[model samples]
Target: MSPDSVLVRWLPVSAIAEADWPVLSALLPEDEQARAQRFHFRRDWESYTVAHALLRGTLTRLAAAAGHPVAPPDWRFSIGAHGKPEPILPEGVPPFRVNLSHTRGLAAVAVALDREVGVDVEWLDRTNLTIDLADRFFAPAECAQLVGLAPEAEKDALFAFWTLKEAYIKAVGMGLALPLGAFAYTLDPLSIAFDDRIQDDPDSWYFQRLRPTQGHVLGLALRHEAPERAMLDAAPAGLAALLRLAG
Candidate 1:
């Protein structure tokens, strides 16, 4: 597996403690430190810190394996005009793309070697959740399908549609610049129906639902086939080890 190839990884953010803060905080760059500090809530601050560290480490390893050998701090990231994070590459380097997402107690990152990719993970248990948002964001058929289900079944399918739609847009590298309503997804056989608004070929993409942990639904989008699903470990060299497993 080329380090730039597609892979999805998750790290548990629930267990990070005061004791681990020192080390985790040190891994972030100065701008990240400032950004992390802006979160007034402790939970938000901690999640941001850990998520940045995970992204930094994972991309560092990917760049090294691609023979570019840039240190984590030296890695430069810029936002695309449409809001996706784009890594600044050195001259003549092979392409490497990554996307990051987190919810409450967990964070996930998706990296692809030569192809663009996206990933999203959502916590399934929610107290104030409503299915009505589907009406605004989902395609007409998708919204109708979700609303027709019994309340229980409606919530079940909503999560799948939400994650898959998010993953698809992130892969498109346009973020929310592309409306969620522009595409529809099906669950039983598992597929997407993209509207004419999207000029890309439907068969050029691949999607997957991943379950590496309980209570989490992971959505993946790749320009290729199934990716190497990597697991985060407790060792200090966490993502590095997982990348080898993925390889």
Candidate 2:
């Protein structure tokens, strides 16, 4: 696939840690170093440590693709009014956006040359946790759809829908502060719609349910119109090669 095409990559959390941090660290700017230090990793290094490192590595490679310096600026990121991480963009570069999600040792990253994007993954456990949380987080119509599913199949489908919604919201950079209860998704798996309660412009948002994997469901969302064809690449060497120019 062309390097300019929209690409999605899934990196196992374990494999990310195995990557050389020094190689990764060389790509990070001083601001990134301070952000890494602020995290309290002693309690839950798996999420913050692994996710942060993977994000840095992925962004380093992405910046290279845009022909920008691999080193990011010393800009500090502050939460938006809606509580989403907004990195201070460096001057003279094309707009670049990324969103990260990890669940059960699997991490997914979505990168766009000049558009905002988000990706999310979830483990399909047999537990009733998703169903319980749906009541609080899901929209009324979504809950209705979940309740209508056959007892044996409801749990899996609910998670698939939930992940898609989450990715959509995060893609918009609003996070949970944006009311999820205000929007409803279709059962067809190809589209999502917002109700009157959602205050944002829905026209720019797009969502798709990815092929299911063993014990996992994946979803991706973006703010641009859907691409004619989407490509998935899993080669770490391809990513590493993109970053090697800065070395």
Candidate 3:
């Protein structure tokens, strides 16, 4: 893969065959198996298995490309302070950052060359989410913009802001430790700015807001090493093409 490459992978979580469970379960580490066992609901357990299986499959494919690779089931991970997961790579392997998000029936993962990557996929039904909560977490300008939307348009805008905010914090690898109100994003130009406190420049990231299917909305963010006019344009054709497979 080139430096500009990004791979967006999505798998359907709601549908899994009973026969496949054993195969998928074999890919999970024992610790992950224990955590999956703790889920009281079988559906939740299967979902957890599928998501982690896909993630591990991704890492395994990364290693396997060299022609002599370890099995995907042998991979292990360590979670950081803010709850981001990192793969334990063997020597001579190129390490990559990852962020994963999953909803009831869908899971999405964004893997990039050598940069911090964050991805969030929200089930867009909106009946379970409320604009009222935006006031508590959204920046003032973001809230004002949400308020100005027509009554029918408010739900969509609320989700757009929520996913963008979530993706940003995930990229920072601090979860909510980074203040939500410390940054603002504009939908008009698809740009972002940080309140004086955050030193990172907004220009250092490439963000994509995509709706791969009617039921889900996705936010993908990649932290770039340097600013470039063609960063978005230079992404390999297969990158955007991969997103289409998300549905």
Provide the overall lDDT of each model, using Cα atoms, as 2-decimal numbers.
0.71, 0.62, 0.73
Which candidate achieves the best lDDT against the true structure? 3
- Pairs that collide in candidate 1 are 4-112, 4-113, 5-113
Q: Which regions of candidate 2 deviate over 4 angstroms?
A: 1-5, 16-43, 72-78, 126-128, 148-152, 200-203, 211-215, 225-247
lDDT of 3 by residue, 1-247 (tens): 5577667777665445566667777777788889989999876787687777777777666666755476666777778899988777777667666677877666677777678888888888747567778888888888888866787588777878888888888888889989889998888777788999799989887787777567888787788855452143211122222222222
Model 3: pairs clashing at backbone N, Cα or C within 3 Å: none
Tens-digit per-residue lDDT, 138-235, candidate 1: 89978777756887688778877888888999887888989888888778767778789888666666777776457777788777543334322212
Per-residue C-alpha lDDT of model 2 across residues 66-174, encoded as one tens digit per residue? 6765453333355656555545566755555667676765656676656667778887763655777889888777788787778757876787777888888787777
Q: What are the TM-scores, per candidate, against the unseen true structure?
A: 0.83, 0.74, 0.86
In TM-score terms, candidate 1 sits at: 0.83
User: What is the Å distance of residue 164 in model 2 from its true position?
Assistant: 1.3
- State in Å the error of residue 33, model 3: 1.2
Higher TM-score: candidate 1 or 2?
Answer: 1
Flag regions of model 1 displaced more than 4 Å: 91-93, 127-129, 147-152, 225-247
Best by TM-score: 3
**Ordered list by lDDT, greatest first:** 3, 1, 2
- Ordered from best to worst TM-score, the candidate numbers read 3, 1, 2
